[model samples]
Target: MTGRPAPAVLPPSLRGWLGLVAAFAASVVAGLGIRYAGEGEPGRVDARIGAAVDGVGPPWRSVALAMDSLGEPVGAVPLVVAAVAGCLLLRRPRAAVFVVAGVGTAVGTATLLKHLVGRTIHGGNLSYPSGHTAFLTALALTVAMLAARRRGRGGLGLGGTAAALLVLAVALVAGAAMGWAQVALGAHYPTDVLGGWCTALAVIPATAWLVDRIADRLVDRMADAGRRGRR
Candidate 1:
């Protein structure tokens, strides 16, 4: 029998890579719109969406609070640790590294964008790209990418297309959920959440690809060195 295929790592095919590039481009375009259209205040779009979502009670508020916590250090740390531990159990060291690197890069990008864009919501708070949304979306994207790797044929039997779609779908859903939570609680404008979502989308795929490239090269070098030593 043929040996099991290697882990998917990042996008496994040319089409997958193209799709990620398109996604990154789309995110950059959206971010540019937000940055130039209204740098420090809510635009018309943000006001309308925020007005619709801003106030709620009971179960939704409770749910939003819980979801919000997932992006915080208190909840985010444990979840990340669990993901890394699970990757080790599955013998996927590169994926474990990706889990850490991907999330860190996404969050850092959001923080940097917040400073650069200088969008504000509540009295001088830098809010253009919600860091909470970025964190949760990054976490979700990392998990989805790992799941794709485990499937062996680029996710659920559909090759690289399936893997790409799976990663994007998971990231989108997670970002939307967190975005809604942030809006509902009046923590951010809708555009701010949108910026955060796009930031993760723009950053994670690139981060995954970079991690794979660097890690693979290092592994190859190590293997060559070992062979030379044995010789």
Candidate 2:
């Protein structure tokens, strides 16, 4: 019988996972700082920031509304579905699963934490983590990760790396804009948004790792099947 093809190692290296862990740790620390701050300093800061945003000219109001809409369930859910469909069309079922699971977990975790923490500020209920921010950030990061993997396979050439970086930069910008828009609309505190982002930072890489493991197993099985057929 022909020998099986060796199992593949997932592309995102150990150091990459470490970086995500560090980011998650930092976000947890930041969330705790906001949570325990006497009289809610984070809430106060959020209010000031929101006021500043409100004062940033009339046209910006429209822009903020537009950005905020991107995070709304009506818009975000459909976009995520479309993205998953696109990934499936590209024959990356694992990537598509990652997108759905990452976003779902991020949003669900934020909701659970909000309820568990029971934080309220400025007459808002269960406002610790911004669900909208978490959803958008997770979606953006998933898209970037899928795009990078799709294009980064050939080689880590300068061109591929540059393209990946460009995609990441844009995704980050869009996520940040959406988060800030949440603050501008008085829907969530800045710390809430930060918590959402941190949650996504923790969830996305971990999800990717899980999906990669499953994909690796499937790939190994396929390779083994082909080897047997050849024999």
Candidate 3:
């Protein structure tokens, strides 16, 4: 036996799978409401959250600015490269692909949604579904899913529950951090950040499942072809 580890399967368990499906649906609905309510301006929720950040001083403002930069192209490219490289270093080619594809798709979807929703802030800037928030959340989700799968506890048991919780925790942390930064910087409305977070939640699990399914099918076909040639 090679004794090497198998590639990680996403969702990690039946409950995890169901949870993802529910999250996706809820996120989609929430995003739609945010879009409709805020199109062309901030919504009721955004208004309550306020348009300005007060009492933020040097380090906190600096930190917020830094966090905001992480969503930009210059910042995001390096992060994506590092994640892909790390996955390849661990000999997880599928995970490498998942990181690239998932992050890109999530960010791209947010961009498309911004245009479609036409939600604007601070003028005509399309801002529903904060792209920066989506980018970080997507990256976090990809990493969490990989970590949970690598734990090799993707069964319908306590381990699976822990894995699911880990993914949720990571996603929330990433989403909240970025969302806070965007709102503080007045770069987006609070509802916009929420929309962005939901966008990632809705997109990532499905992307992971698709990547796994396609990669597995390709590997199986290649293995079959090799056997037929040998015979």
Task: Name the regions of candidate 1 deviating beyond 4 angstroms.
Answer: 1-8, 14-30, 33-38, 152-158
Better of 2 and 3 by TM-score: 3
Superposed on all Cα atoms, model 2 deviates from the true structure by an RMSD in Å of 4.4
Give the better candidate number (2 or 3) by lDDT: 3
lDDT of 3 by residue, 94-186 (tens): 788999989998999889888777778766888877899999999998887777754433223336667678777889999999998988888
Candidate 2: worst 10 consecutive residues by lDDT? 1-10
Candidate No. with top TM-score: 1
Show the colliding residue pairs in model 3.
none
Question: What's the TM-score of each model vs. the native?
Answer: 0.88, 0.76, 0.87
TM-score of 3: 0.87
Clashes of 1: 0
Off by over 4 Å in 3: 1-6, 9-38, 51-55, 152-158
How well does model 1 score by local distance difference test? 0.78
Consecutive 10-residue window with the lowest summed lDDT within model 3: 149-158
